[model samples]
Target: MESFSLLLRGFSVALLPWNLLWAFVGVVLGTVVGILPGIGPALTVALLLPVTYDLEPVSAFIMFAGIYSGAMYGGSTTSILMNTPGESGSMITALEGHEMARAGRASAALATAAIGSFVAGTIGTVGLTLAAPLLARVALTFGPAEYFALMVLGFSTISAVLGETPIRGLVSLFFGLALGLVGIDLQTGEARFTLGLPQLLDGIDVVVVVVGLFAVGETLHVVSRPHHASFITKVRGWTWMTRADWSRSWKPWLRGTVLGFPVGALPTGGVVIPTFLSYWLERRLSKNPEEFGRGAIEGVAGPEAANNAAAAGVLVPLLTLGLPTSATAAILLAAFQQYNLQPGPLLFVTNPSLVWGLIASLYIGNLALLLLNLPLAPLWARLLEIPQPLLYGGILVFATVGTYSLNSSVFDVGLMSVIGVVGYFMRRFDVPVAPAIIGMILGPLAEQQFRRALAISQGEMSVFLTRPLSATVLALAVLVLVIPSLLRLLRARAAHQGRP
Candidate 1:
């Protein structure tokens, strides 16, 4: 009851007219960037972080939270309309959502996605509010070794298991970790890889890396190709979900919420794992699995629910332990630093207003998103009519402007070109960009923690395994890396023996 009262008070703060307006604006901006390919919540939030430096704390947090939630909703729009997934979390939705569009049931697909998303986001936020304190207590017990091991597990699972190929994924991760090493050494302040350049000493900015790899890379890749699809889609029929659609969708939404939270709480890539897991679960239990690749409504409902639920679930660990399980969450963590705040076990006590108010705004933001997206679906779908050249060209310009605005560094713009070219080749070779981003973000943090753990134990490496939680996380990391090799060997053996 005490927690409930505090949460209500938090809602009172979030419900202020000014905060609500910020939330609305954040959602709109989030949706626009989400509809565009390449740019996402991470890039948008990163670009906006400095701008928030002078804003009021509550309103700034409200806007950032709205962007966090809205990005999930925005990704589904592109997945359904363009067959180009707005983000990796929506890839599963694209599988079914795009198919539904082809079946001329785009409205049904969009309706169910929006509703399921709202349900999941609301429930997941409730779960977070209820469970966060207990989770934080568990996290508080973790020593440096445990945190280091947990980070290792996070890096291994996200990089090894989620991409088109584990090799390509690791290669991409290596590229990122390599880039992360470009800055001066933290412990000694010695230049490791700067090659005597003054620009390299300050380390590459997160904004520059994100903009270069995600924005510029995607734009260049798109420009390299010439798309010839028709300008307009034939959107038809009713916009509201029918009773039958509701009956078919509600169960998956529930199941997805249940499946999504724990995975989201874990230190893997944000919502992608849970979204894909829900899609696979729905397909397996579907009354007609054949309907899966051919416009199965459950596909859209389940993944969308899981996507938002997972998005909300990620907030629990992020706020409680300062462990960002996804790229966007990492950027949010940086935003916390930007505000001279740290988010870990002590955060609730230290910054109760910011923490609880952010949680409360989540409920408000989810409702706002549902209302905004329902009748506005057609407006977003119109993006399909814009010429790819013009759209991607605009992306190139915006990315350049945003990057330059950060530091006005012409050298960063030049470096962006280099990173963009590398990213272009990475995409061409089926390498996943998410892992690269994750690796870049987490690499230095992990190194610092690893060093701290060693210092605490007098350089004894066995401390990592002596701690129960550390051992578990390290074992999971090893298993994650080794399982794919085992599976490949098993497949090869079966093929050689002509076994089914």
Candidate 2:
């Protein structure tokens, strides 16, 4: 009942005229960026940060919520039509969505993906509305030791879960930690890795890093590859899903929501794992398993739903614990910092209206995406016709301008180019970019907590293990790191025995 009342109040705030207009603008812009390959929601939001500098925090966040949801919807359009995914989360959708398009069932594929995203997004928002506050309330009991342990869990799981191997992920994470150390030490106010540069005192900006890696690096990668013209299938039939399509899609949608939100709400949740899990589960349960690689509507529906749901789930940590589990979430955390607003237990108490209104806008954003995509998908498909050279050139322009505008510094732009080069090499070597971003964002906070916990314990090393919550969380982190390697060894041994 309390949640219901707060939500109703949130609706009142979101329905304000200016806020509604911002939401519309954000969703439209997000859809456009998501349709263009190599541009994604994080980069889009980072680019728009300069434009939103004057807007009120509530309106700005409402707009960001729309962009976040809209991008997820628009990404599927590219995946289905052109076998290009605007976001990594949409890769699973392309596996079967493009196949459906090739089979002339493009209309059904698009419809199921859009509708499933809407369903999963709505459900995930509800979970957010109910779950975030409860988690925030529970988090009030945590001490510095517990918080440090929790960060350890996040660091361990994020490194292990992403990339081709844990070593690659760890390398990326350590690199980020090293980068995070470049600024002055917060406690002593002493410079650590300034390298005699004035700009290093405040630390490298997250926005600059995001644009460099996502926009510049991705453009370079696309330009390096041989350009192949994409073939888009024309929509030949009704845009609406048929009864048969609905029957096959509904179950996967439900199952995907169930699988996605919980995993995503975790402190270290990333969209990739839940989406893959949802896809594999759907394939295993499917009555016609052979249709998986061929044009299976269930495959497209399930993974798309899981993708959006996980996107929503990322907010759980960001809002309740000030923890960012994904690249976009890390960028959003930077946005919050721009306003000097920390999102955690205090955010709800200090700004309940902003918190609830953002949540309410998510609901509205999901609906707006569905309505916008369903009628205009044919037009959105035309975006694929854009010339690669022109598209990449525009991305470079935005990346440069966004970085320069941060402090009106040309040096920031140069720094961004250097990071872009590093990002390109990271991509070439199959290193996951997300872990580095996460590590850079979380490393300083982890360091602060570690020092605070030690101080509270009078420099006793056992403080971390002496606390029940801290010990348990650290143990869980160790298990997360160890379990995967043990499982791999066991599987290898079993395979060897079977072969003999």
Candidate 3:
């Protein structure tokens, strides 16, 4: 009840006419940047930091919250329609969503994405409001051992995304892990794979990889195969979700929210793991698992929900413990510092208005994003109506510009083209690119956490087994890897016996 009362007070502060206006402006700007490739909420917020020097802290934070939530919603647009993800969190969405667009189900994909985002965002905000303090404490309990174990659990999900055969997926995953190792070693300061290039010391940007694989590679593949039919399909009408679609999507949205929030609240967690896990879970629970790569609505719905919910979950630690789990959270922490305000438990007491107001604005921003994006889903899907030559020409230009904007480096653009060619060959060989992306992201983090744990325990390998949480998670990871193989073997044995 006390929490309820405080939230009402927050609503009072957030509902001010000026505050509402700022919120609207922030969401609008966020949506635009999110639709464009390469520009994510972190960069957007960082760019706005200098301009908001004179603004009131509460108003500025309210606007920031709006941008954060709005960007999560907007990213799914490009992922669904163009096969390009505006943010890393939306990358999984492009896999199935673009396929749906190819099959003339773009409107349905957009609708489910938009609605799932809203449901998950709103529920996640409620989690933020009521359980932030409790969840933050839980996040604090995760040591390096536990975090490493968690990464192992994430690694186990690679089986779900591995397409066609395990061998192909392992090849792609190993490639990604190799790419992830290209930068300088953090602890020793030794350059591992820079190849004497000054630019490579900082490591390859994930945005460059994503854009290269999806947009540039796709454009090249299509251009090379001019005799094949056009990829885009014509829309029959602006049909939203049918009754069947609603039944299929709602459960995934809820399950995704369940999976997304707790993981996101962890200091070590980010949007990637939850979204991937959600996709895996949906595929496992799905009635028609084969439809996953071919545009399953549950595939679009679950990961999108997890993506937005994880976005909200990132705030729990930022608000309650002053921990920045994700890049956007880190930038928001900078925003807090710039205002001579610190985020922690005391901030909730000393500046209840700002804290609560920001939370309240998330609720407002979610509703605003839903209203803004829902009506435009059909219009956005119509991007496919353009001639194929013109559409892909624009994608190439857009991909190049977006990749270049990361560091303003011409070399990065060249690197992206190289990766794009590599992506084309992966597609040609029917290798699953998702495992590569997963490995590229998680491999480095897992290595870091593993080293940290060993250093803390004086190089004792038993630390992971000694801790109950770590041991439990490691066991789960083992099960994730072993269970499917066991099941497959049993079925094969049964078939052989019956045939004899």
TM-scores for the candidates: 0.94, 0.97, 0.64
Write one digit per residue (lDDT tens) for candidate 3, span 222-337. Answer: 66774745343444478889999999999999999999988887654577779999999999999999999999999999999999898999798678766555656756876787
Better of 1 and 3 by lDDT: 1
Pick out the ten consecutive residues of candidate 1 with the lowest summed lDDT: 230-239
| Model 2 Cα lDDT, one tens digit per residue, 1-500 | 78788988899999999999999988998888888888988888888787788889999999998888888988999998888787888999999999999988898999999999999999999999999989989988888899889888988888898878887888888888888888889999999888999998889888878888888778777777787877777777665788999999999998999899999999869888888999999999999999999989999999999988998999998998888888888778878878889888889889989999999999999999999988888888888888878988888998888999889999899889888888888888989888888888788888999999999899998999989999999999999888888999999999999995
- What lDDT does the true structure give each of the candidates? 0.83, 0.88, 0.80
Whole-model lDDT, model 2: 0.88
Which number leads on lDDT?
A: 2
TM-score of 1: 0.94
Give candidate 2's root-mean-square deviation (CA, Å): 1.4
The residue ranges of model 2 lying beyond 4 angstroms of the native Cα positions read: 237-239, 497-500
The candidate 2 region of ten consecutive residues with least summed lDDT is: 230-239
What ordering of candidates by TM-score runs from best to worst?
2, 1, 3
